[model samples]
Target: MSNQQPPRRFTPMSQFATDYPVLLIDSDAPLRELHNCVSERLNAALKYLHLMACTSLPDYAENDINTVTNIARILVQDVSDVFRVIEPRGFETLKSQ
Candidate 1:
């Protein structure tokens, strides 16, 4: 008898269209959720950065300028935090398959 293993099957989302298009719809829900969450966080960061930029006026005192610079730095750290939270592990799974 042959010792070969059976071929593995990959299920594409389109296959759920018959009686369960809902599965396809539900499958996209996680992506949409992540998109919305990330967009909101990034927009908040941008708003904070915009406030800092606006405050960095030519006539600003040294302390005020320093504060604005610190805010910009904090926003950069916040963006990095968001990326760490949302980064996916699916690429490794695809490679293994």
Candidate 2:
């Protein structure tokens, strides 16, 4: 007998559908607006939470609101930009179409 491996047969699984349609939705403008709104809200909430938490500390100062707000805004912007850049496929698709 010849030493040869049997040919592999390719078969499609019944449970899986190969040609399922992909529905691409366009909502970039709304999504960006929502993201901006949520980000601003979250940053404001965080600033308030930080200020509240700081109030409980011994060295808390009421004059630090500007500094805290500035820092929080910077952090929020950086995080927002990072998120936008990393997952920009949706935005790109929206722009292209």
What does candidate 1's lDDT look like per residue over 23-73, in tens digits?
A: 222222354564565577578778877776676377788898788767666
The residue-by-residue lDDT of candidate 2 on 1-97, one tens digit each, is: 9989853222122222246523222223455764665477567858766766667554656667666666666556545543543356466768999
Runs of candidate 2 exceeding 4 Å displacement: 1-63, 90-97
Residue range with the least summed lDDT across 10 consecutive positions in model 1: 8-17
Q: How far is candidate 1 from the true structure (C-alpha RMSD, Å)?
A: 14.4
- List the RMSD of every prediction in angstroms: 14.4, 16.5
Clashing pairs in 2: none
Each model's lDDT comes to: 0.52, 0.53
Error at 84, model 1, angstroms: 1.7
TM-score of 2: 0.33
